[model samples]
Target chain A: MSSPSGVLATGSAGDTRPAPVVSIRGVSKRFATTGDDVVALTDVDLAVAPGEFVCLIGPSGCGKSTLLNLVGGLLPPTAGRVEIGGRPVTGPPSEVGMMFQKPVLLEWRTVRENVLLPVEARNGRKGAKAARGRADELLGRVGLGEFEERYPNELSGGMQQRAAICRMLIGDPDVLLLDEPFGALDELTRERLNLELAKIVSGTDKAALLVTHNIIEGVFLSDRVVVMSARPGRIVDVVDVPLPRPRCLEVVTTPEFTALVARVRELLELGHDDDGKDGDR
Target chain B: MTAPADQRHEVPAPAAPPPDTRVAWGERPSIWVRIPTWISLSGFILVLFALWYLLSSLELVSPFILPDPMDVVAELGNMANAIGTGGLLAEALGITVLESILAFAAAVVLGLGFGFLVAESDFGRIVLMPLLVAVNAAPKIVFAPIFIAALGFGISSKVALGAFIAFFPLLVDTAAGLASVDRDKATLFRSLRISRRKTFFKLQLPSALPFIFAGLKTASVLAVIGVVVGEFIGGGGGLGQQTKIAGDLLATDRVYAYGIVLAVFGYLFYAVVAYAERKIVFWQTPHGVQAGG
Candidate 1:
């Protein structure tokens, strides 16, 4: 029930615009329960161009996660179509990498083995063996090179999430789907991880879509912030962040950064008020 | 705020403190303050032995009912000598050990097969669970006479009874372990689109191993007890028959000696399974180690 505002950023809008790597058009989802069918989303449209980082943010149960799941092929949209690389997504696409809120590392496997899970699933044991060098490089980039031999239970929460990020990268996927990957960490750890994530995705051709609850986080790491409304979710605003690339944590101190954060916050409040007035009708 | 800075710097004298005999959290106590487990256990055992000896010496209980501790010890020595010479005691111990091992093997195979069925399919759970519960509810000893009558007064009947008693624990624990996989981990597998076969082999089986081992430990002890009870009811070969014969002759000391030997053998069976669990499930954190953040 979001009030429509500015024109949506379709990534296919302008004549010079590149074709989007991930495209969702007029997607809706509903869940059938014993009493009623819960409408999770309604007529949501979004696209991520190559090298663009987009974040979806809203209050709880706003279906930001539902939209992410649709793109990842974990759930099918009830109405419109979701496509990756111009093909309809019927199942988990090989070119898309996903990271969830929990690290969800297999407890019995070592750090290196956990990172290679997707590789093994796709290509079996030999493929995982051939990719060990790439796994090591990714782990080293995240400061986990020395701990590759240790099991998941031995690592701290922050370290486990870093390992999960390494896992997402190991597949060499063209698009990344992240669902609040750092939502459980402490404030300081979350900030540090945000910086790390930004650095990792900067020079890459990969298109990234992140779902988060933190306003500062959505603004800090994304090129566009997709503001969503409460249940029966729809996009209310898509704020383009004009901050320069290769950004650092110090950018938050700038007046320009403060204004963008304020803008997203305002749209979120507007959506929240619309939800209260509806009152589950 | 009214007090001068110099006066505030001076601390007030406190009253005499009460003694703190309570132990501090996570602090290791001095050897003098806490007795080791083995020492306390053995000390309590020795006290019980002393009490038995005093009661017997004072003639508080008749000799026919309560033999002296020295007499029981002498009987144990005699049995040990007989075992070394490959006599009656040795034959009985060998037979009992063989029956227990065979029964344990049968129990494990049947338990794992049925456990997997119950855990994997709705039809199996709905049809088999009530039957399993009813079988487990009945006292297994009640079936010994029937087994003896059907299978004859031989090793087969004892093993049948033992396996029937031992398999329930293994089946129940295995089903529980397989069904208890973490929800988030299952989602992770689905996200990767892992095949169902690979998921069972790579994820569910490994996670269920610790529970299987726990069941094995309990079942090992039960197997031995079941075999002995079968022998007791049917007067078949084994230490149980030996104890019955000694009791009929009013040889209380011999009965006590056989009971002690059976207790030791049962403990050995349990200990072996526990040792195997530790070796196979080495990834399990030690008792006090914190696992994840």
Candidate 2:
């Protein structure tokens, strides 16, 4: 089997990398309920290279989000360990920035203020003021420069998400974790944001792990797509997206992209069928 | 893409033209709305004064029963002179104001602390909330006599009554306000790995400010009532005591004067609370003004 282009790209740079930015080692999460233990994930091991765009795709209740939270140190693994930059996952690391499915903008603050929240929370006024220029720059990059003074309620769904993305990037984190950040948008808007996200990820040095259910979006935006099984989720397949660099909407219509989407879809279908038998386990 | 004037005319006109033109034409009358509102308000006051004056003049109302407005005004003037010369009315008002202020401060601090505690912990909520509801449901007026008997007829008794009356609203409103935080926002904070204390300050407190102020507004009015009740039940120096003296002497005009002073005092307390609510929660100013008028 051919190695992933992402690995090859790093290999061709003439430096054999020593360690991945994030590594999940035999991680499993089980939640306790009345008289039963609900296994959410089981023996999930994955590694993401530095600056790589990795996408996790699975059906609902498949523990994709659980895994994302585990990697982010929001939740501890029940069985194994999750590490970031060679550090054992403890609490939230300032080096890792996170964004949720919703915009999660503080309604009381303006757009500019919302984008500067992490900077203010992690740092003080001096850091926030220093980050302000960068916040405005990101907003302009995301086409929201004119809306800095507007409240979150006044902005449309897509604009709010754009602001959220700017917020995620404002802290200048080395790693970005997005849990279905565009899952709430319409199909048209999601496709548009997929392209925007691809451009943003390519432009930054941050390693991003995106959890999504959209197969096409997974193929279009990721360097490597990790397909997950249903509840008690584990990696079923890891497909390398061979699409060329600087992808756009037109890439979705290509045969190579469609074949990759089909392969991921097959893995998900098989995972779903296996999940049916494992329901009682 | 401009249509000819003839074709524009051919397009049927709306049954009612848009109000833009009418609003501009009738701008003068819109300004007059405030004048009529003020006039109607003053007119109602004038009607009340007229009835009082006419009934008292015609002897249909006994002077000992309902004194004339003129008589009340004259009494008020005389009392103002007496207040200038170290009379009970001014001294009583000063004592009442001091008592109410102390009680209000204590109520706010204690109520906020307890509210936050009950809201943050499940055990506190389960253990204390039911007991609090029982205490709140009890007739707090009974506590006035009990407090006067226990604490004696001094500033402490009145302050205790006022604080007791004021505390319930602060507790209820604070709990309600903290509880009113959006669940989605809480989940967002959880995913961010924000600490519980930070979440309370950053998310819960601001969101609950409006409700807490609503409680305080209600409590201000209750605080005034509590002080007056304390004065009435216990024999202390306040407007209520002066009112009692006027009632015993059958000097109806002096009673009316004291009643007016009490009304003004209540209105001022309410106005101060309303003003504070406006300034502190300015984010809700637009909505408050719209709803108030």
Candidate 3:
């Protein structure tokens, strides 16, 4: 699956004239503690083109999740700017959807109702019927058509996550931020969901930024994998996956996939060694 | 394996379990059990009547000290007749009911308003909570006399006393209910960026209903007691007035009859409040069962 010329097609160059869907310029986040200030992210400059799939991978406490939240406009940057669709993000954009590590489904609401929550919050009752129909279609796409009437508690962990994914799409947002969306599931479940998510994202025009600690997952799913360093996290390298499109589970067993995984693993270990040196200082 | 198979065939099969004759207890208990309950209650009444008859027949006690139960029953008959003559008993009962109802309404409105205000606003809670404690701690009987001195010996005094006595529970319970919303639920709303008004109405209020209703039940009973105590202190009419009249004339039988009427009124008032609580908080009843069962 390696590109002989060492470049993956990043859509046509002509289509890149429009401003990137999200642009982060020299952004840093610092949090005050009892006695010292903690730096989470530092001088992170990144841009996501329209319909791009980017995965941020790092160790625990590396602030990859913080970067995702910044782009979602859930937090204000202490030092830099984050723009979405060419507009500076002062607050959560109506066109940006977020899915947290947990499903965050309202326990009192059914699966279908949970999916419809965003639409109801944004549009009220006027668009409720259309929202319901869209929610049903999304649920079907996520392989949960028969479980729409069931409550979150009645669903398995994987199914609950699927419902949450449907909810994220219900608003028809242009940008989707996923914070370790499959990090809680077992190995088999996470693998199955990764395949399903690839298909789902490929079918939509939304630009997705996934935060994960899994190296294989980053290679298997993202168009470009952004490897980040430890605390005061900054992007260390951007590795473009040259694997062919329409990837399946079989792709993970190939020699090309193993080499990409090895490269990410070395970068992550290098991030850890750098952190070790900083701790000593 | 051959021996085991032969033994299985040799074993005598049990009879067909009597065609599973036993049936489940019906969805509800049978009428026969209910009939006996009624009959046993009537038997209790008969026993009381026989005791009354035996005591009166033997003249076992002084008439002034222990009026025969039959005499009280007869007084009740006369009381019914007095209802037609001047409608005295009915009028007193009407006034008592009216006073109780008015006091209950006033207590509920004021208590719920103050409770929610205190629960919702930190400043209001800090300032008003101490004042409420002071008011609740004072002897309500003192308020009864003061109410009479200020409002005069009329229905207003009784109503005031009832309202005063009933407000504390309503305030306490309503505040507790409002304060008891789950913090996790609040965080969920915050994460969603739900509006504050929507959070209060949809999440907090519905969750607080059971606690508020509990306070109402306690306040209703207190309201009845308040009215009776107020009447006992100074009142122109009601069962308390009749008690004073019977005491003055040394009509013990008539006094007992009034006491019985007061007991029935108290029971009825409590029952009505309980019934309303069940109706308004019906979701709690079924939801609790599903959670714990």
Pairwise DockQ winner, candidates 2 and 3 = 2
Model 2 residue runs over 4 Å out of place are: A1-18, A146-157, A185-192, A273-281, B1-87, B120-130, B176-200, B244-264, B284-293
lDDT of the structure predicted as candidate 3: 0.77
Q: Judging by lDDT, tell me the better candidate of 1 and 2.
A: 1
Write candidate 1's Cα lDDT for B193-233 as tens digits: 99999999888988899999988998899899889888888
User: Each candidate's interface RMSD, rounded to one decimal?
Assistant: 12.9, 12.1, 14.8
- Listed in order, the DockQ scores are 0.21, 0.10, 0.06
Q: After best superposition, candidate 1 residue B174: deviation in angstroms?
A: 1.3
Candidate 2 on B1-293: residue-level lDDT in tens? Answer: 22222211111233554567756777555644657788888888899999999999999978999888898999889878877987767798778777877778778886787788788789769999888889889999888888998999988898899889888889889998999998657765665566778888888998899989998888887887788788888867987777888889998998889888788878898899899988777666532111000
lDDT of 2 by residue, A175-275 (tens): 88988899898776676666777777896667899999789888889988988887667778788886889875677777898899999999888888755
Q: Which candidate leads in lDDT?
A: 1
Best by DockQ: 1
Please identify which of the two predictions, 1 or 2, would achieve the higher DockQ against the true structure: 1
Report per-prediction Cα RMSD to one decimal.
Answer: 8.1, 8.2, 10.6
Model 3 chain A weakest 10-residue run by lDDT? A1-10
When candidate 3 is compared with the true two-chain complex, its DockQ is 0.06
